[model samples]
Target: MKAPRVAVIGGGLGGLSAAALLARGGCAVTLFERSKHLGGRGQTSDVEGFRFNLGAHALYQGGAGMRVLGELGVKPAGGMPGAGSYLLSGGRLHTMPRGLVSLLTTDALGLPGKLELAKLLAGLGRVDLAPLANITTRDWVEQHLSNADARAFILALVRVMTYCADVDAMSAQSAVAQLQAKPAVLYVDGGWSTLVSELETRARDAGTRLELSARVSAVLLADTGARVRGVRLADGTEHAADAVVVAGGPGDIAALLPADALLAHDAARAVPVMAATLELGLSRLPRPDALFALGTDGPWYASVHSAVAKLAPEGGAMVHVMQYLGGRGPEASEARLEEVMDALQPGWRTSVVARRYRPSLLVSHWLPTAETGGLRGRPSVEVPHVPGLYRVGDWVGPEGLLAEASFASAESVARALVPGQQVASRRAVGR
Candidate 1:
């Protein structure tokens, strides 16, 4: 039997995962990446003995990403951040309430607010979130809680979890599902590049050809424009393939298939989630106790990731301060994030070993909104009217969020391409 040749675009997590899985499933796979480096947003940089991810990043313990990595036999080493965190409200930092003792002792919320919050938290697991897909987080909060402080606190938590500051536009169902997915997250050592390296190695070992710096100009289709024939590179080189998977943002996909109405429509509906971040490698943290803080009155987050992950040298600290942007100008957003740094680490400027400020960073390609039916509303893996053409990315799948969504979409594409073959059994047969 002739093996089906598959071409994967964008060498990020999703592309790499799909390439490896499909190759293992008796398909000839070739992955093309525009950049010299892989990982896309997952790439990490090192400066002055400190490793910095593009922004604050964590892996949900039981999410689709972890499951996919496990299936690929890749184990990432990291540590979970401690529960000791603070809430910034009214220009004051208060110990975040975690358990029963802290809930009673914390001054962040009043007695009534605390009781209401506790009750809400207790019942989060049992709540049927499927019906809440069309409800916004703001509406959900307003309808469920009367205490102002509790309402604000819950909104802040949702922002931190989903990294989307537009609570009025975000879907409550997606927010609640993310919150209920076990709050434990791992901060990877050596940053997310660890996962990238592992996936790349596996892809290569599985006989999948990876072409770096290969910019795909267009996804070539047959004369009828109904099926994928191959991909054309920027250099005018064309590679023939039986299938092509586009693993990138909506803009990338739309640009490739400019005449496709479905791609155009999906691109118009995509809402980007952006953030301003200031990452620093400090000589030492001035206020070590203020390791993690979330703003209750604003969209701000500060975390010392090096405390849990080995991202810095001995005694050095790596801090990431971010402000989830909600239609705010980049200049103002950057200033607000700097203010958060000032509050969390007083006199931090003096101890700065290295620093990078990104005014506008794309946190996610699409913000799961109420109008779109939350996560389930995203586009499917197969491209409509274009057989053998698929899409995989953070914004394409119905399951998971962020990197998890990327992995989930990639897994779906792999399963669709080769239905009955398992990764282990197929690999044993050898490419």
Candidate 2:
């Protein structure tokens, strides 16, 4: 049988993973990336001997990202953030109540609040999430926890876990699942670009032809408009393919399709999760003890990522401060993130060797809303009414969140394209 020719649009993790898997499954794969570089948001920048990811990037140990990377023979190495995290409330830092000891001793919450939070944490994993799929996180928190401090603390933690501030719109089931998953995460050494490099090497080794700087202008369809013929480049060049996988955000995919397509209409309605971030590379830390902090009074987070990853020089530091944007403007959000940095790392301005302030960053393509029924409500990999056309991205999957969802969606599309191929079993990849 002649091998099917597959053309992949976008060169992010999802696109690279799909291309590699398809090639390994006996398909001839060609991957197109619009930018001169691959890795989309996964790309990292190195300045003054400090490597910085686009924002704070972490791989959840229990999520699909690790599992898929393991199957792909890619092992990401980094250190886990220690348990000594702080909670900022009333302009003071308190030990974050994570385990039993902290729960009992931390002054972040009162005795009643601590006990209530402890009970909720203990029962979180065992809770029946199906019934809560349609419930918003705000509604769930309001109905379940009576202690104000406990309620505020859990909401803050949810923001850290989900990178979302819209609790009133976020699905409770999705938030709970994130909390229940293994709490450990890895800040990849050298930045997230390491993972991108690994995936790129694997894709090329598996016989995928990567075409960087190649822009896909549109998804070409047959005369009946029922099947994907291939893709047309921005320069008027066209390549034939048996299948095409668009691995990008909703808007990117929507722009390539006809305005009348249902997928395009749905994409227009999808809401993005956004954030404001400040990344700094410092010559030295002003307050080394203040390594991590999350705000209970607002949607803010600060972490010394270099402490857990090899992103800085021997004695230097790399800190990331972020504000999960709800309805705040870019200027306001950036100011809040700066305030968070000042509160967490005093005198950080003097030690900074490099600094970057991103007023707005698209953290995720879609916010899993209660109205949409959470993760299960996301679009399927297969494009309805269009055979041989597929979509893969963080917003087009039913499992995991963030990069995990991207990997999961890619695997799903690859399996659908090559039905007989078996994905490699997950291996024990070194951290």
Candidate 3:
């Protein structure tokens, strides 16, 4: 018997991971993507001297995240700076406060401020967050952070990095995840795109039909109650499948599914995020030992991943600085990016070589629920809403960091195919 035919939409990490797993399990999987590329937001690009990371600035693979990769036999390399971060506070670049002793001794914060931070950090795990889940990050910080100095110096540093979020609208659960657990900032080695490429390659090699440039518009159901029939693409091509995982965006899925079924889904609320990447001449660099820091002044927020010694040519180095903009993104993000570039490195006219960016591509995506269960009553990734149609993505809900969540959600969707389906048939072929 032929394996069940599964249609995996969106070529991003999650979709690719699901397709790979299903194909390997003996299901004939076809992966579709609307973009010309496969990585979705998980992508990379090259300019004059800099290589830009599209999305997912970092990943936390300390526990469950790491376990998921192990289950998929995926290994990753470090993507962020290793030593740590330097902060631009009060017009000066200071070393980041690490331990309790360091926090207390730092002149940036007052003695009382340090004490407050001490109390806060000590109670990190015990803090009641549910009441604060719907509140914004700014509100959370102002309410709980008692020390002004710590608020400005330490918390603000995190704020700039969007620990709370660019708009400060992120839930306490979202921000608390960073402060509570592993507390380590990291990136995939060789950039995040490497991981996406790995998943795509592995899945395609495993008998999966990876389809790019395909757009899925809706899932059509038959007369049978709760029975999912197949999906209809935007271009009018219909692909039949035993089970479908709506792993795109929750808001989008909610809009596509019948209103009756959508009652169970919370309308995905996503904030905006805009970023900029600049490629410059290595000669303009201040040297490797010069610590990377972000100024509170205009648009620049985060900076790292400059392997001056490795990628720079002769005496010139390349660096990519990312600035996240919130609210009314597209135009505002581009405008701020331009403003930040001109302000941060005013010497660009003389010291820089070339810079490239897509101003209009700026996207404001939805945030994931604090936990998988945070959705409370949302449908399962394996369980279809209108019977045969399922859902996936951060909007639907992310496992954690988007990349990992995408993979997890997609896999869950793939495994949901019913018994005797092609997927089941293939799995039982040799057994």
* Tens digit of per-residue lDDT, candidate 2, span 1-431: 99999999999999998988899889999999999999999999999999989989988886778877887899999999975589987767889876899789998989999889989888987887777779999999998899999999999988999999999899988888878764688999999899999999999999999999999999888887669899999999999998999999888888888654687777877989988889999999998888999999888889999898999999999999988887332333666777787878878889989999897898999998989988878888998778988999989867777888899888888789888878743221110
Give per-residue lDDT, candidate 1, residue 208: 98
Give lDDT per model, in order. Answer: 0.87, 0.87, 0.56
Using lDDT as the measure, name the better of candidate 1 and candidate 3. Answer: 1
Instruction: Please give, for residues 285-335, the per-residue lDDT of candidate 1 as tens digits.
Output: 898888888999888899999899999999999999988887332333667
Q: Write the per-residue lDDT of candidate 3 for residues 161-180, one digit (tens) a residue.
A: 34223534455555565556
lDDT, model 1: 0.87
Model 1 misplacement above 4 A: 327-331, 423-431
Superposed model 2: Cα runs more than 4 Å off: 327-331, 424-431
Q: lDDT at 136 for candidate 2?
A: 95
